[model samples]
Target: MTKKSTIKVEEVNNQIVDWLKSYAGHSKVNGFVIGISGGIDSAVTSTLCAQTGLQVLCVEMPIHQATSHVTRGREHIEQLKKRFPNVSSVEANLTSVFDTFITTVPNNVDAGKVNLALANTRARLRMTTLYYFASVHGLLVAGTGNKVEDFGVGFYTKYGDGGVDLSPIADLLKSEVFLLGHFLAVPQSILKAAPTDGLFGDDRTDEDQLGASYDELEWAMSQAEIHKSSLDFTGREKVVFEIYTRLNAVNQHKMLPIPVCRIKK
Candidate 1:
């Protein structure tokens, strides 16, 4: 039997719509801008923003993106614009930009961590593109990061996916975001698509990089706060615990604000 969500989907939708409108009104921004990655988090967040009846600029900045990823993004945007006149889209292919940066930034230094660095660079490029549109149109960039990525494991890149004017689903777990996606009637393709960062080149998923499923990671994170019992974790459970703590510790820097050197007067 499928377990029902404790959250009332309908009520949650309405409340979030109201909050989006009220916050945008308070900020006096023209509309909300979001990077539509064809994933549940972005799809759900975009739907919520559209529900507010505000102008939403969903940008698809593909840099060496897979064909399927681009197709999914466009399909969702087509549906979004049909349902909400305020929803609009723009495409920014950052391939040349990234290529230029890669060649110049490293000065051909041959760094071993180039792949990971390039992945984060892709995110930052998208971030720059979103902000460019936001600044030109007087919009605020709405982040699509969810709780597990943002707070649990810090899976987002600093000043990349992590940089945004607002984060609508940052409080919701990955499972909860899927729930909201279903409730929002997000594109079936998006709802069914496997969750990925779209940052890694070889089309690796968050699970591939994280070494555990979101459910296990979430469970492990929840247990991190409680006292551990020797019997609490079995073989796989113990592995999950170790993966969670290791990732949590390494990504601690990503979770917090940049450290500043304190000057003593």
Candidate 2:
């Protein structure tokens, strides 16, 4: 059974928008740049940023092999443009860059680690593009991670997709994100599509990697929140214990600052 989210979608959206704008102001950012994955999270984030009167540059960085979500990205961008005339879309193909880097690396590395390295590389590539555009246009990088993904599972690459100047929906859960999308009138198709990171040749979904459905994970996260145990080892007890424990242990890299030693002056 899935635990219901307690947040009011409209209230969360308004609060996030106001908070994001204030963050932008404090950082002296004139606009925002974001990468849209054709997933609901990015769509909702883009919509909120646009509605806030920020000049939004939405980039679609699709590898040549994974073109399935390209059309969806286009439609999302179009909807954004209707509300934010200043919104712009760009296509950045990452195949050549990924290929060149992989070819140069020695094959002695573990294949699984190599694959993760490549995925992280692609994420960094997208971030690099956003940063360059932001620097040129005087905009901030708008992040699209939700609380379920970032806080619960820590499902983000460090300094990769994890890099952001401000996150608009960092506090909202996955279920709440859908509610916010519905309240904002986001396209129904995008809101309903299975969430994916678009990182693999097979076009993998987030649930496949996470070992559970978003509904399940969200429930576990909510329980963890109430229990104040970042790991929710209740209900399904064992399975939840394994998933929560492993994720927290392995993904701790996502939670900490790079270690720096204090030198005596």
**Against the true structure, whose lDDT is highest?**
1
lDDT of every model, 2 decimals? 0.87, 0.81
Residue 110, candidate 2: Cα error in Å is 2.3
Question: What is the C-alpha local distance difference test score of candidate 2?
Answer: 0.81
Q: Can you give the TM-score per candidate against the true fold?
A: 0.94, 0.91
Task: Report the number of clashing residue pairs per model.
Answer: 0, 0
lDDT of 1: 0.87
- Please give the distance, in angstroms, between residue 148's alpha carbon in candidate 1 and its true position after superposition: 0.6
Between which residue pairs do clashes occur in model 2? none
By TM-score, the best candidate is: 1
